[model samples]
Target: MAASGISFRVAQAVGVGGALWLSGNIAALSLISIPALVRSQTEDSVPTSILSRQWKYTFEAGKSQNPPIAVATATSFCYLAWSVRAGTQLGRLVPRNSIALYCIAAILTIGIVPFTIIAMTPTNSRLIAIAEQKRDAGGSVKPNDEPVEVLMKKWMFLNGIRSFLPLLAGATALVAVLG
Candidate 1:
């Protein structure tokens, strides 16, 4: 019983803490980093190479960092859910609602990976290709695609949507905890 409580606390800490941290990181990029970069230039046109490098650096970093956090968070939440599932530890003591909420958190937290692959991949690929093409040209190369700002704006929108997942996951877990 004491061991179960200790493990439960650990899982709750990781699940809730990781969800909030992931959401905060993603939200900062969508709300602060991307917009600041997009608005930095005073000219009518923004530079593709600059945007590309910036996007590439941040995207790569996030791609490496966020998925692991998401997985850990979801795994923690899964532990919580499994603890309360049938024929499992603490199943009799913990309520059914928390199990359901933890399951939801696990889904929403881990869902960011597939969301990025499916929903954000097109824009990411386009940006990467444009960046490679234009970085050496020093923005003198006329883009064959849409304006870099337009594409970036689209990316910001998509990223904003993505940021909500972990936030929602965190909120769900919080609700479960409060209950």
Candidate 2:
């Protein structure tokens, strides 16, 4: 019993910490990074080379940052799952909100990967393709498929939604802790 209690507390700490880290990262990407990137570019059709470089840099930066976020998300999900299971086993001993918190946190943390696949992956692929083409062509290849501005706008909009989910998850986890 004492061991179980200790593990539960450790899980709670890891879950909340990971959630908070993910939330901050998402918020920065949405509110600062994307916006800055958008602002740096023009609304008019820009040179393919310039846009390609920007896209490549952005994508690379995101790739670099993704591992830590992925780890945090996975860690949070694992701990939240443990808590949910443990709370369920405790039955009446666990408060309803506490159980709900575990459930909500688990769902949101796990949901991000699927959400990215469905919502963001298509655009990301398109952008990556365009970036590669531009890189290979030595900056002369302009994407005839879509305007750079349009793609960036779409990416930013979807990313805003992406950012919101983690923030909400973190907030929920914090509330769960307080409750």
The 0-to-1 C-alpha lDDT of every candidate, in the order given, reads 0.85, 0.67
Residues forming the 10-long window of minimal summed lDDT in candidate 1:
134-143
Scored by lDDT, model 2 comes in at 0.67
Clashes, model 2: 0
Model 1 residue-pair collision total: 0
Tens digit of lDDT per residue, candidate 1, span 44-149?
3555677677778887898898988999999999999988887766777766788999999999999898999999999999877777773343555556558777
Kindly give the stretch of ten consecutive residues in candidate 2 with the minimal lDDT sum: 84-93
For model 1, what is the error of residue 28's alpha carbon versus the real structure, in angstroms, after optimal superposition? 0.6
